[model samples]
Target: MSTVSTPGEPQARSKPPIEAVPVRHPGRWVGVGIVAIFAAMLVHSLLTNPNWGWSLISEWIFAPPIVKGVGVTLLLTFLSMIIGLALGVLLAIMRLSPNPVMSGSAWVFVWAFRGTPVYVQLFLWANVIALYTTLSLGIPFGPEFFTFETKTLIPAFVAALLGLGLNEAAYMAEIVRAGILSVDEGQEEAATAVGMSRLQTLRHIVLPQAMRVIVPPTGNETISMLKTTSLVIAIPLTTELFFQASAVGNRLFQPFPMAILASIWYLALTSILMVGQFYIERYYAKGAMRELPPTPIQKWRRRLGRGGSND
Candidate 1:
């Protein structure tokens, strides 16, 4: 028999309550355990190993020559990046030029530098004496404005700087070009409508917006340039960090410890660079995103708050 409900009566709703279930990831736990065990074993080995010569590492870590080498490495990084970025800006502007000749020249220069191995270029520059007896600043086959003996003028240090700076310029050119291209075309049109000159438009409007895209990569390049300074060893630049480390290691017959010292210094330098990069990235990120991402410290504080609440 079926029963009919009155028109004014409300029907009772019957449904089970929905409950959330936590997902199980046994594989993640297993992976974490394995990683923990491996880390423990590695730490134990490093601590117990006599062959590591921790004392020698400590001694050489702050040695006068190594300290000087660190300074030299920093100087090279600063100078190379400055020169590279300057040249890169010019090349990028040329690449965007209306003139085919300007664009073509920029392209060729970038292609030549990027195509060759940096190490080989360094070596060639170091031994450039074999290619040219003297280098001249004046027009080719014309009146000599100035001339320099190749051997005296292009020492190992100069060769290293030239190679690193020039090679870096090729990469920076591409980076800068990408940044320039990221700007809105409409922005440039609006600037032009306002009677802004091309240079004025680029300087005042386009570049400021482009920096949001450009800065992160530029920071990366700076860090990379810092590490690339180590490769100046190919030029046999004796004052550089890696060369100094190797020389000291060979002399002491404790190459492993010296290597460890170098690694420590490199790690410290990279840590400092990473912090600078973080701040620079944050500064440029302003107004680009609706909400800024939390920094590490903020994340930690949030975690602490959550943990306290749970407790």
Candidate 2:
């Protein structure tokens, strides 16, 4: 059918529809199948392995000594992280200071601590009484202040705490400094324009913004510190989980079971930490994001809803 338009009238034109395209991913199904098969095999081996000594593991799983060791390990991790965090904040502030001396001192501390192996440091701390028999308070090279024996002051637990906490402070300082740097320079300038001192600006504006960057790595460090607490054995801290479990194994001549027990506890603790980290990360992401990411539980529920709809 044909229609002629008048000279003053405009003609309406029809547009062509777009063609649809289907994407192909043939290897995706193959990769999924391979992963599924590997998972099945791993589960099968774990279930059927006879050398694991499941009976001994079950017996020692809730033993009083093991429970006590677990508690000590947790306590060390908590205390060390707290010390590290506080000391790290001071070091980070120092690193960012305008004074060259402050920055240099902070850098030297980080260099020394991070340069040496933590195990070696632990051993040295454990035997520090050899280098200095006594520790004292008051003026140095003057009238001696009240003195205390080094051995008396620094027992196995104290030595362990000192080694772990001091070493961790070095690493935490870098993490904190990076977090601080992630904040905008413009923000600092703006704060100064309003007559806020550097400390005040950091406390009120910068650190709060930096927390979003800080929290994730700090959570990772916390979990790592949990595992690193096992190294407290270098100080001969026999009350820690690794040492206690190994001691029990040596006594019973059943190393595998005791090792398994320790591993199970470590896994359980790390799993809890992972869940806590997830929630903490989500909380800190609030201001930076328009919408929050779905959690594992939410994703599962969404998948279930979709499946039900299909049915």
Candidate 3:
């Protein structure tokens, strides 16, 4: 029921709605403006600078030799990574072994490789024929059953692979060991209680969980390996991307431009590897995370959907 107000009494009134103001981040805006200005300036310089020789870069970028070099680079990267990863796993297991001999041997392997410079190692591999003219397959301290010349057996390509792969294995061993150690001791104990052998426990229980740690560094190493393939020049492996680009530059008298072209290719390859690494990390994160993060495509799709609804 409505009530009538008494004459001359004070009247009640409704309060006006409050208007909210967003917090301003002036510092952030200033930083963004500074970055935008620098970026625009860089872009402008790139477009305007004739000395950069963009035309030369474009011309040599797709040349047959360059393409072949790219293929070689990829092959080297893939093979080296395979060697590193496979041997790294074995070394990591050995490092963690109960026996002192196995662990000590693994440690020595790691130490020797890690202590030396890869360039020096590559140089040594290339010149190894000087030290050993012939290698033989036979029982040690017994008559040789078969013999092969070291120079013939270890070519430039083979030397490059050995140098890069063996060096990478030393690094990968540490990475794998760190990943394995990241797994809880309880997980191994539980597996053992359930009648799992050491190998079985590592394979089924520990390694799976450890992958969350392992995949990231492994991905980084893969990308690093791609660039490090450039150092195969120490082996005088002239078929690699950087060496090919430099060769082209020397022939054309435009070394700087060719270097730029090689860099572009490296950047593109590295970007692709980075994307693959992201997905791999996500895959291994399944059990660890409550919800996996969305991919770039998924994020774009969501944004597009929201925009359409807004429209």
Considering summed lDDT, which 10 consecutive residues are worst modelled in model 2? 9-18
Question: What is the per-residue lDDT of model 2 for residues 229-253, given as tens digits with 9 covering 90 to 100?
Answer: 9997788888989888989999999
Superposed by TM-score, candidate 2 places the C-alpha of residue 24 at a distance from the truth, in angstroms, of 7.8
Best by lDDT: 3
- In candidate 1, the residue pairs with backbone N, CA or C atoms under 3 Å apart (3 or more residues apart, or in different chains) clash, namely none
What's the TM-score of every candidate structure?
A: 0.88, 0.88, 0.91
Candidate 1 lDDT by residue in tens digits, 1-311: 33555566566534445666767889989999999999999999999998988888887888899999999999999899998999998899999999999999999999999999988888888989999999889877888898899999988888988999999999999988999999889999999999999999999998888888888888888888888888877877889888899899999888888888888888899889888888777887777888888889998899898886532
The models' CA-based lDDT, in order, is 0.88, 0.91, 0.94
**Candidate 2 has what TM-score?**
0.88
CA lDDT for candidate 1: 0.88
Better of 1 and 2 by TM-score: 2
* Residue 285, candidate 3: C-alpha displacement in angstroms: 0.6
Show the colliding residue pairs in model 3.
none
Tell me the deviation in Å of residue 300 in model 2: 2.8
